[model samples]
Target: MRTTNFDFSPLFRSSIGFDRMLNALEAASRAETMDDWPPYNIAKTSDDDYRITMAVAGFSQDELDLTQNQNMLIVSGQKANAEDGEYLHHGIGGQAFQRRFELADHVKIMGASLVNGLLTIDLKRELPEEMKPHRIAISTDSALPESETKRIDTANQAA
Candidate 1:
C-alpha cells in the first residue's frame, strides 16, 4: 500500500488577500518569541468585563505596577532586595519582569489587584451603541435635478 497526499497549492494560489494572511501569520510567529515569563491567564469575567492573572510569587504589591497607555497594557515588576537574608536553600522566583499585552481599540482597564501570589487585573470595555458601526439612511432624491446641477456647476466654475 502507498500513501497519497492532497496538494494545497490551488487553495493558496486562488485565495484573495493571501498576502494579508501571510503578514498576519508572520507577525503571530514573531510574537511567539517574546517572553511570556511568569505565565498568565486571561478570562472573561462578564459580558463587558475581563481579568488577567499572572503568577507573581515573590513580587510584592509595591514592586508591581500596571498601566494602560493607549492600546498597550504594561505590567512592570522589580524585585526590591537582592539579598534579603542568609538562606541555606532558596527556591523562589524573585526577578524583575515587564510584560506587555496589546489591547484592542476601545478596550480600557478598570482596575487591578495583587492577592495571595497572583496579580489580577480587571478590565471593562465600553460597548455603547454609538461605538458600533451602522449604516446611514440613504435619501430617495439623492441625485440632483438638471437645474440645480447646472447652478452648482456654474458656482464651481466661478470659484
Candidate 2:
C-alpha cells in the first residue's frame, strides 16, 4: 500500500489557528481509500458562509443524526427496519453511513434541513469582536499636550 505524507509546515507559517484543519487534511490524505457512498457536496454560499448537501434518499429526519463536537461535524444515518416485499432488483442504497467534516475556528452550524431527499447543512463563520480587526486611533501632536506628545515622540524614536 502506498502511503501519502503531507507537509503542513508552510501552511503553519501563514495560518494562526488552523492546526485542526491541516491535521484533518493530512489525515484524509492518509486514508486508504475514499468512501463515495451517500455522496455529499460542499459549497461556499458567500464569504464566511458555507453549505453541505448530501443525497440521503431513503433516510428521514428521524433516522439521520447531526452532531457538532468542537471542530468536527458528524452526519450519520441508519435506516429503520421496513417490510421487505419480493424485490426484483434493489438499486436504491440505504445502508447506514457516517461522514465527518473538519470545521475551521468560528465556523458554526447555523441550521440544517432535509428536503427532497437532500440533506442540507448551513454554516457561518462568526468571529468574536475581539478577534475582528479594529482601527487604533492615533494621537496627533495637536490632540495631546506637550508631555503626552513628548512621550509619543520618544516611543517612536525608540522604535
Candidate 3:
C-alpha cells in the first residue's frame, strides 16, 4: 500500500484536544482505499438521527455481531457453515467480513435490525444539557449601589 505523509503541524497549532479526530481521519483515509465488501449506506433519518444499512445477504442475524467501544462501531459476520450442496458456479458471496465506523461525540447507537438481507443500525446524537445551546437571561435593571451610580454619573458629567 502506498503511504502519503500529511502535515498536521498547522492543524495541531490551531486546534486543541483534537488528536483523536486527526487520528480517526487518518485511519479512515487508509481504510477508504480497501475493497468495499458488503456495500453500506449511511443516511440521515432525522435532525439528530442516522441509519447505517449494510448488504449482509446470506448471513443470519445470529451469525453477525455488532459492538460499540468508545467512538468506534464494529460489525462482523461469519457464516456458520457452507451450504450442503456443491455449487457449479458460486456467485453470491457469504465470506467473513468486518467493518468499522467511527462515531462522533454524543452519537449513540439506538438500535439495530436485520430485514430482507439488510442490516440497519440506527444512531442518535443526544447532547447533554450542559453541552446543548442555551440562552442566558439578560438583566435590564441595574444592581449597582446608589453611591457607585452617583460616582459614575459625576464622572460622566465631568468628562
Candidate 4:
C-alpha cells in the first residue's frame, strides 16, 4: 500500500466542526482500489429510503452474513461445500467475498432478503426529533406586554 499525506490546515481556519470530513477525505485519498467481485448497486427509492442490491449467485441465505457496526455495514458470503473436480468451463463465481459500506448518520437497515441469486438490503434514514429542523417564530414589541427594558446606568456607576 502507498502512503499519501495532505495539509488541511488552511481549511481549518474558516471551517468549524469539519475535522471528520477532512479525515474522511484523507482516508479516501489513501484507499486502494476496491474489489469488483460480488457487484452491487445502491439506489434511492425515496427521499429517505435506500436500497443495496448485490448479486451473490450460488449462495444461500444461511451461507451469507450481514452485520452493522456503528456507521459501517458488512456483507460476506461463503460456500458451504466445494467440489474438487475438473470442469471444462467454470462460469458462476462461487468464491468467498466480503464487502463493506460506510453508512451515514441516522441511517438504519430496515430489512434484508435474498431471492433469485440477488441479495437486497433495505435502508432508511430516520432522523431523531432533536436532529430534525424546527421553525422559529419571530416576536415583535406589539405582541408582548409592555415591560421596561433593562439598561446599564453609566452615571450610577463609580468611575
Per-model clash counts, in order, read 0, 0, 0, 0
What is the lDDT for 14 in model 3? 89
Our tally of clashes for model 1 stands at 0
Q: Candidate 1: misplaced stretches above 4 Å? A: 1-26, 133-159
Once fitted onto the true fold, the runs of candidate 4 whose alpha carbons sit more than 4 angstroms away are 1-14, 145-159
Task: Report lDDT (CA) for all predictions.
Answer: 0.78, 0.91, 0.89, 0.90
Clashing pairs in 1: none
Sorting all predicted structures by lDDT, with the top scorer first, yields: 2, 4, 3, 1
Residue 148 miss distance in model 1 (angstroms): 17
TM match of model 1 to true structure: 0.63
- For 5-107, candidate 4 gives per-residue lDDT tens digits of 7777788788998877777777777778988999999999999999999999889999999999998899999898867798899888988999998888889
Model 1 Cα lDDT, one tens digit per residue, 1-159: 443444544656778757554544455555545676788999998887889999998888999988888878999989877676798877776778899877766788887888898999988888778988899976565465666544335656854
User: How many residue pairs in model 3 have overlapping backbones?
Assistant: 0
Compared with the true structure, the alpha-carbon lDDT of candidate 4 equals 0.90
Q: List candidate 3 stretches off by more than 4 Å.
A: 1-5, 141-159
Query: On residues 1-159, what C-alpha lDDT tens digit does candidate 2 reach at each position?
Result: 778688888998899878777878878787777689899999999999999999999899999999999989999999998969988998999889999888888999999999999999999999999999999999776887766554335655753
**lDDT comparison, 2 vs 3, better candidate:** 2
Position 54, candidate 3: lDDT: 98
Report the lDDT of model 3 for residue 68.
99
Model 2, global lDDT: 0.91
What is model 1's C-alpha RMSD? 7.9
